[model samples]
Target chain A: MKYRFNTSTMSEWKIAVLFLGYVLATILAPTTAAENILNEESARSASEQQKLGAYLTRAGNCMGCHTAQGGQPFAGGRRLSTSFGIFVTPNITPDKEAGIGSWSEEDFWQALHQGKSRDGRLLYPAFPYTEYTKVTRQDANAIFAYLQSLPAVSQINPPSDIRFPYNFRPLLSIWRALYFKQGIYTPDQSKSAEWNRGAYLVQGLGHCNACHTNRNLLGASEEDTLTGGRIMGVNWYAPSLISRLEVSSGDWTIEEITELLATGISKRAVASGPMATIIRQSLQHLSIEDIRAMAVYLKSIAENNNDDTSGTLVPVISENMKEQFAQGRKLYDTYCQECHGVSGEGVAGIYPPLAGNRSVIMASPLNTIRTVLNGGFPATTAANPRPYGMPPFQQILRDGEIALVVSFIRNAWGNSGSWVTALEVDRSKSGER
Target chain B: MMHFILLITFLLITPVANAAKSVPDTIAERVKACTICHDNEDKIERHAYYPRIAGKPQDYLFNQLRHFRDGRRHYQPMAILLENMSDKYMLEIAGYFSTLPLSFPPPEQVSIQPDEIKLAKQLIHSGYPARDIPACSACHGDTLMGIAPSIPGLLGLSRAYITAQFGSWRNGGSMRGQVSTCMSEIAKKLTDDEVNAVTKWLAAQPVSTQPGSISVLSPALTNRCSNIVLGEHTK
Candidate 1:
């Protein structure tokens, strides 16, 4: 008694109608902040508060920025170089003189919420208080408690090396007035609790927007959401999370996205470079439910489309390009074909397939070039303890050779990315920001 | 219109002058200072002071850099230059130097007595077995070119440089191998005359036509020197 009359088409129609209803519901929901709830979160048991603090610290990736190269954890001296200035991270250890030991819970809240230091000096935005301003008072106190629990280490924060006009602190007020907004995440009534939790973490503590959004001339983020752009000074592109043309996970299963968030490698994709650091230090520590929630939110935001991986469009190759292409094929066979297959289908779970990989076919060939030059090492999480590493080719391949091989992969197996040039490779090698 | 766009692009992309002026930031440009001493041209009349770093095995070169940085092998300027470098930076420098392909000039025919040549060859090829000394070929490949990754080649070095190294090893000077200081022990065992003879013969021998270090390492050598592992004992 099965009544099958184009069930797949019917399902698609149903999904579209449901999606439209959800969109309309979201538009009609009134936006409001419950400021009273912020104080209510603080009255937890001391031990429970400590545990939560530690977990939230991992969620926020506090140690990744604060700790210097080969220095003690949170005894901050890490340097971040940007076009605006070179900002040195401050010590957050509980040392009386050098760290945040003297700061009360109220003082900590003022710093996180108001972007002001204990002495009432306007703190630099480099500290990411712009994002931290959205963090709840309870979460801030928990992080503070965790810092208070750590053994004190005395290391004075180095002053940032900013250029003349930026070095003037008072000027930040103007920038803040124009771009900044102060508020905690107010949950949308239309969305589920899971979606709201995901929004809070991603928008506030995770600060995904920092690298994933483009910046304007004054170094303010151009968009509030993750329509990705090139991370200045680092040279890696954080591809858009919402676009079907880019790194959207809308088509991916809930399990696949959750696995990638939890372990840094899923069946479909593997995280590398800056994302690898985040996975190792932050995402891997989070609970499975929270990771799934983030995935759910991300998937919901992804724009719909027919599969970008399927159709094969023939590319125009010039006589000069043909010769270059031949040379690239030879290089690929010699070096890459052993791991990534002859047709660019890499081993599942171990070596990610280049075929249909969004990262490979990305408009900017920066990440592909970088992975080849610096080696692709996914984070060593509990799930994938001994992740197979891609050896760096910088020593073996010259700028031209790297360009050719990278361009070959991008264009092979129905992937239609732009050809990488030797000049771009040279620029990247010279550490061009 | 296209030309105007290109001009704007160039202006926007250019780094601030202060950033560009600070240091020779690229690994390739930064390593230019090394050529001032190493002078890795493979000349017939070689500089006797600095060893040619150009075509040395990468791990061998890497270990030497670490030794200099960590104070195991002391040269004040070398130490200062490498003091703040991370292991990864040192590896990059090593890799950069190791891949520079250069043709070795024929070895300079240093005048030596036939007796001295015989003694030197015996010590290098079949070391004094009674004194528990292994052949140079046991670790450095049969061609006297290095084994891939770690062990350094003994050929194409100046006689003076070779002699100085032996002296440093014997006298408990700055040079110290991390594994066991097996070199220091071997240096102590060899007589000054034996070292002198060995250096003269080594200097006289032709550099291997081989482009890079040989791939295989002998098992006997590995048992003798824990420091010279088969491949990349990076730590």
Candidate 2:
């Protein structure tokens, strides 16, 4: 009777314990699972914010100006030479002592929207705050978060070396009053959302007019126009975005314009020098839709400003220039014909065709002069990696020869650019604007 | 041409007077001190320690100047001299030196074991494939005159200079962080005795009648070296 009681009791005790454990687990699971879900949602939202901020930062090309050559990214000491004076960019890293780590999101928004520092100091126009003023508060907040997320770098920013009258910080107030306007971009209700998005990016974050428009002596832009101008300090010129005589994309397909913006090269054109830098650092990183939007906006502007008078003014070849023209053709055959072709038509896409290229026929001729003398690669991007290069002729060609060759190509193939003088070439050679 | 003759006449008329006071302000005048050590004299003894740089490829000369300027090469005097030079100025100096007509002394007669000569020839011509070594002629042309743009000729170099270069490459002194991995790798692979034999043989060889570097590179050898790009466009 005692043995039968021992086996039954053992089995019943084990079942009772197992059922109790299952009941406890069922009761406790929901609280922990709900807590996990809350944590995950917050984490994912923060990560999404960081990701968008990073993308916008590239779109703005903050690193291009903020980072000095061979210096840590965003720990800025870049010396930007302008007509006013040299403006050294400030550090934007998250170091507590040396950077903007102590800044609140509101303080950062004030800097972008109002061009005022946390301490109420007026920032220079060289920082391009005039363009940043149009950035949405939400986007500005995202950029701040992204910058804060960066590895903190302890680097002290150097004071800008602005010349006499321009160095006076109060003078910037008058300049800002005359030139700058602080406002967020308002979408045009009449236009398509795509067009409105393009306008916001180009006018706000893209800052296309900062380089494309001519600046007055006070360093103020003419207007929110994409007409061409010479970039201060750098002898290279930024060609017009609207004029067909310079870099109009009016006739180009949207896909073609997008390809050029995204890849730095299209069948009809290639970006070199400053534009090349922009494509490499900023435009190349944007989504195809955003780039297409930019193209659409630029093309619309170009169409409105496009004049049929482009390429109609043929320069008369003077008696003195005839010999130069002959010499240039000979030189072109010997050196440039292999890649640029016998008729001055460059290999399509690989080597930009010189025949109808707007860059070659631009009025200033600085771009063509610089390109031949210095030689350059079109922007190296993911879509167009291993781009072809032009060998620098500075060593091989003299000032006269460069002038002649530049003049030859500009006039050859139905182009109407004026002949460049040897003196002009000489000036360019010495890097004197 | 007339101005050159006039300069010669002026020099001949007052040799001592012109020599002290009338050196023309030109790249040739600026680099006169370099020629004192890197002598290009035709009848000088062939055993000089300094390697002749005249008539080398322009890009090869330019790269050397940059290496010295950037402290990639260990030589202090060269680095000091080239420290402040710009790329445009360096190209000008390189062009001046590269355009000079080439002249060479007869190859020095070296006394070495026949077996050493055979090994050197094998290494230079065919290379030891077991060690994944490429032939010297792969990048440097079959004539050892180098392929144009950046490669340098092997012939007419002093034995001391060649030995020093090999040692430099082996120790990673000259090509510090440079992309030309083949030379350093080759230097590390070769035994000291093999390097000695190779240098002796190379130094004993006569300079080719056709001077400077050849522009054409063999398609097979283009990818063997890291720095050189095949079919690179140039003037």
Candidate 3:
């Protein structure tokens, strides 16, 4: 620049330097400001994302099955009893050696979406990845971030005590091939947003089908997810959600379903057994909107025509049957009339009504017989802190006597359900016990 | 026309008489109605929350019935059942239950920790002077078998029932009474831990061989409980 004293050359060089400086400043200044903004935005969103993830985790009730009694939360050692064998839950904490700490977001996503580990190892269905597979990658990443934020607990999970053929990890791949489908939920265009959200939660994070859907011998859920099934090895029936004659029947209002899920008690039913646990741990914590969404979805499930009782012939009460009814009536008067009411119209807020109660009159009389014989207490929850209980008649009533009482409840007070035979009662009682 | 009228009257009167006859008359038969929730007389400990009323003091039982009827207590079923009953009939029922022989099964084997037992023993015998909580034995008698006519024995009741009663008292369930109940006053002074310990220990205790009401009052009760009355006939 000093050598070129000529006016034109000097002006050109000055212009070139000015342009270069302008380019450098223009490129550097906004990037630095943008970096600061990006940092602040990310920091803010990260926490919000974590909060959402925490909510989702609660909705999924991950800690319920993962955390063992007296063990660190999420540092799993709980033994889940199944018909196949006892499966020990693994540590989900962020420990590098014992948990998923070493895993990348992709690895975690693979675990949930494909039921596979970072090393391409197949995961057991007990992890509930089949349902988790419907989870979006963004949501999976958020969950991973939340898990990573937790304190790393180095708890080595006990090895599962599964039987030989089932314990083989390679077999899980074959099982996945048959049963597992890797896909995110595609919202139905025709349904409302609430319904779609409910479907997503029910089919994915809530994993209602894990207990509610009937499973085949191979442990794959049968075609219909809402049709209901027996809980394996537990001898408790998770009644059909779709059937008009079963749980959440056609007569139930959406509000009743919401109330039952939120408070563990409703006009029509109370949450007992496993359902109580689900309400306490999972459903009660959800937002009212989410609960309403679930109710909407549950209500929209079409009533199965097969459940219609119109085609079936009501049995004629023979003289012997009349005698049995009389005997059952006497037993009811002596034991049940005070709380259940003379007409089976139970006292509001104190006792559940037996008159036209779906639980009492469902096609499967397993729960009723078991409830009468063993007596079940309603699940104590925040909403229903002082729930009324039914005392066990196992010690007081014989099998035949239990059968009579159960049959009486089923057939009494304008209810028209199939008769519960003594043999059925005996079988259910023994099986449950 | 007169004969037809007489026949119609007879038909109506006969059905009414039959209905009256079907109603439980004897105290034993009437008490059988209670076994729907309460256990049978012989096996009174079978139900968890239902108290054994078979051998409770006559005055105590009468007062409870009165309280239920008068809305001083709040059990819907009890209130409804006792609503129309005459005071004399309730007293008769109470008298019948009181005279019946008291029988209790062996104390239930509840798994209470040593620390809990220690806390229970402290509260039961010494009382919490710092919190102004009097010893349970002060009013319940040194044997905890209860004093004459009105005080109820704590030994034969279930832990759940005892706890619930204490909880009710603490929650102002006895506020309906014109005078503060002794239970309400005592329950208010106790911490939740103390309540739990006391109930658990009391439920696990073996009822004394002489489980019947005593003639004398507990010596520690310098002040009489206004809510309790020995009823002229019971005395």
Worst 10 residues of 3 chain B by lDDT: B226-235
Shift in Å, residue A301, candidate 2: 0.8
Calculate DockQ per candidate and list them. Answer: 0.03, 0.02, 0.03
The 0-to-1 C-alpha lDDT of every candidate, in the order given, reads 0.76, 0.76, 0.74
Every model's TM-score: 0.64, 0.65, 0.62
Whole-model lDDT for model 1 versus the true structure?
0.76
What is the C-alpha lDDT profile of model 3 across A1-433, one tens digit per residue?
Answer: 1111367877798678657765675688856755665587679879988887878888888887788643688999978877779889988899999988898999999989998889998988888888998877777878888888889999998888998788888988789888988898888889877888888888888888888878888888764367878887566788888877777545667787888888877756776656766776678888888888888888888474555563375778899988988888999998888667799876544467899787788888988887776564455456765455566675567788888888898888888778778898777754322
Docking class for model 2 is incorrect
Q: How far out, in Å, is residue B178 in model 1?
A: 13
Give candidate 2's error at residue B81 in angstroms.
24
Candidate 1 pairs with clashing backbones: none
